[model samples]
Target chain A: MKLYDRVRVINDGYEGYGIKKGDEGHILNAEIRYGTFCFYREDPETLADDASASVRIEDLELVEDGGATDEDILEELPRHNPEWGCKVIDGFIYNLKGERLNEYAYDYHHRRIK
Target chain B: MKNLEALYGKVTDYLKYGDGWVRRENISPKDIDVCNGEATDDSDTRTCALCVALNRTVFKNDNKPDYTHPYCKCEQIPTAPPEPTLDFPMRKITDYLFVKKRGLMYSMGYSEEDAKEVYQMIATNAKEQFKQGKYFLNALDNHGQKVNILLAFPGKREKEGHVYWIKTGWTVYPNGKLHQNTPFGGWAK
Candidate 1:
């Protein structure tokens, strides 16, 4: 997904985040962390991107606005982090095992809890 | 006086200094949230004062290396609009938390795919660990060697009701240079 590309949520989105199934949100930015997409609630009042989410490319059907194609979208998607690409779910970092790591405690990234 | 004592309950929270020693903090849960993400602002679940001030002075501010509660895995903002909890049905660990960077994975002797597999193993089986100055992990490494792991859980949040969410984890080894790059190996050991 590219910035400002109109997209629709295929599956029910995260309710806690106020995302619902079939909710049409604008792709505020892609290349979020890993291969995830960041979008915003389609509202003028909303300034920042409403949500940063990882959607299966299949789960999001592209909204045609004279924007990029399937290949373009896929190419823009990063396989992994070019930088220290940690997943920040609701602003906390976790390892792949669903356990929590205290990386963001301080120092932009906190020193590891010894 | 007795009521005040009950209100400001003496809770000795663990504090870390630069020298790598833990200092005992005698604090009382303040009437307000006091920065630690207690679920209710009410008295029952509140954390104490010294802990709150230390949280801001050390963890929230620029004070070189940071200090943290020994048990708080996730650093949820201790303020209004508590961070959202895991929406999905709570499980042992979140399967979605992946390795941070591709090059880091390569450096750690793992292909992107292999690193993902390793992460999957860590999150699926970590229990609530509360050991100070130690890795609270018990898992097998890729080669089946038993290892200690650290996972970040959702810190104090209202959605989580002042409890922790076992959201993510990472694996570590003692002699990390002997094996993969364990992020917490140097300090955690």
Candidate 2:
């Protein structure tokens, strides 16, 4: 229902997208691109560890209260490396050092930029 | 070629189903040099990055690919998966991104008319940086390995001698193909 909410797949419609009933994931984005919610789903059994996908809102059931928020992510970002500072400018997220921090390129861990 | 044959068999076994198996759809002879599997130079092995990723995924349950003995030495089996060749799907750029992020592209030294050129530049640079292991690992979602890289281009302030560093996102698939996820993630330092 909200970003960072832990949810479980409750619909079989997402089978083709590699999701199935009872699969758990963390919501990443909500209802922007044509009402589809994007979430990061991981299945250790099949080695789908880094999997993410988007589906209709009706397919998910919220399982937890909170996961990560904007402030939470930003607070965690600097701990990955002391030199990094995060900020958002004009709808795009970046580090104080000027590194882009959006999309799959998001180095909240500061692993790639340094 | 015995080592290659053995490696191939191992991959096939791991991906095998009762009556079906993973398809080696995009693999080509040119992508891997089997005849020179015994080459002294690592180019032949390096070229097998895709195959290495494939097998690496096969061994994911154990967290590492275990290629053994004669095949290990004779085949130059790398202890780790080599940097895979990147797959930049052009339509993702020309059609979707160019239309969606026209402003961001322009800010990064790319114009509406420079879509193809810009895409080519990103693809080329991404491949080079990836080979150098400059990419950062992001979360794995969508059944793919999410990674990011910082790429530099002639900046919007080019006349002032500034280089624009952009963060690009990609999904590295199990088959060793990488598809660009975000053409732009904002300007990098």
Candidate 3:
């Protein structure tokens, strides 16, 4: 499924065609102390130049739900991604990994944590 | 009178040589609204005279610090006495009080004299209201040594007439450090 369409589906709280093993996804994480989220793709080589790399999630989950079978290794995906880039969704951007993201451009760009 | 003398001595002792202390006096409800430099109304003049008398006693205390008694006529002004029985309504005013460090009073546009006059008027009113059993008084700190007094009148209908009172003052040590004292009083319903 297209990344945008897949994100739209999961965000709606419905389990559609699920993320497959070895299929690259993005991870999003939140920095609670700073009141900010981070985004980064799992593998840089898999990221398409034109495709978004990251998304932001409400929080990190230790295990992924909605796997087809119990044998499926529930990969804990970050709510944010960096390499695949970001897309604005629902006033927030969701990445291929189903994570939420934000643009890092800030007043003091140099001081931003990578 | 001996008690007054003894109280004066204690206050002066607290003042020390070049030291400063605050002098508080009880004021009547009628005197609360009077303005500065304006002739005090006849009814309240007696109250004002009491304040002046207290000021004189504070001045005569031998224990007071040198270089002009730390008792600047500044704090000699009368304040409303606390009411233990009557209930009065408290009203909040939009204007906030702000005091600057080093014994300076600051208001948006008012000169030093003007600010002092306004402050005196407000303090008087707050004290009177407290006596009438209306509101509460509070204080805010600024730049360490300076403090602003707030008169928070009661808001609840049942608490309508209680007033809170706060008076802020500062003493400067020889090392240039400032010590602050904010005495609080209340007129309970």
Candidate 4:
């Protein structure tokens, strides 16, 4: 089986729907993590169009030493807003609006890890 | 929902026999010829039969789920199937299959029109394989008859590559056949 050399992080604007840069809506101190169980074909078009595409969460680790204390966390608040919406599923960070984020989330949250 | 089922059935028939079956539904022959283009004698009957069986077995629900209309036929469905507890990694296999086939198609420099046609062909074939129960090896299922298949491919993202994942639901047959009712959009990527 072929494994991706490096996981691609498709950070587009989907998750941060109503939330803004400094808004509390951005999940910053919540130890947010995300990943996906992707079903992709070699071709870009197919990969893009796969309706069944999904992601899964393996683990959610605390953003330990996120470069600061509470004061530091607050200082870095703007940066914490996941320049894009970063969700944690099965211990991986993934963008929400990408091709497989929802599927991955469903699989992981629903415990369909394989 | 019944209308949606009828539409789904019609689309499946169209995939199985090209546009001819649709033409038989009182559609004009000229429209059929235009939509289907030139008919190739290389059609595989095995794929058609498998599609018919898979749709019947997997999507035969009488009651519609509380999600979007099943017959919408939009690129993205408003709702997804309920997540199952089974650990069948069928999504991985389906992904691998998609990547393998699409990668080959892309490498061959197929035009958009050709790619779309080929994509539909692959989906139909996969549905047939699933129906025949002869394609995949490892799978998991719940009591509801929902099955998942795990698949892998070997290759790099830029070059040849293989990866693993799972796929769920009855729309896809257990044998790894493509659904005859739907056109494959993967090739358009």
Q: CAPRI verdict on model 4?
A: incorrect
Model 1, residue B167: displacement in angstroms?
A: 29
Model 3 C-alpha lDDT per residue in residues B16-94, reported as the tens digit of each score:
5233222333343321112211113235434443232232112212222222233233233222222222111011011
Per-residue accuracy of model 1 over B1-189 as CA lDDT, tens digit each: 755543332221122223232322223343112321121222343543323332221111111113234443223222221111111111111111122123323333445444434444433323223123223323321211222334442222233333222222222211111111122211121
Model 3 chain A worst lDDT run, 10 consecutive residues: A67-76
In order, the interface RMSDs are 17.1, 18.4, 32.4, 17.6
Candidate topping DockQ: 4
DockQ scores for all the models shown? 0.03, 0.02, 0.01, 0.11
What is candidate 2's lDDT per residue for B1-189, written digit by digit as tens? 977876686666555432222223222233222311111223544334334333322112212223333423222122333345654555446644555445556655566677787778888888777655577766543223456778987755343366777777765543344555566644565
Worst 10 residues of 1 chain A by lDDT: A78-87
lDDT of 2 by residue, A1-114 (tens): 444466788887777656778888655432222234566665443212244567655566768755344444343331233233233234333543456544433222333333
Error of 4 at B117 (Å): 0.6
Model 1 stretches astray by more than 4 angstroms: A32-35, A44-52, A64-114, B1-189
TM-score of every model versus the real structure: 0.26, 0.40, 0.16, 0.24
DockQ score, prediction 2:
0.02
Name the 10 consecutive residues with the lowest summed lDDT in model 3 chain B.
Answer: B86-95
Q: Fnat of candidate 2, please?
A: 0.00
lDDT tens digits by residue: candidate 3, A1-114? 111111211232212223323333322211211222222212223221111112224322212322111111121111222323233333444344555444343211122333
What is candidate 2's CAPRI-style docking category based on DockQ?
Answer: incorrect
Tens-digit lDDT track for model 4 on B89-124? 222223222333444435544333454444343444
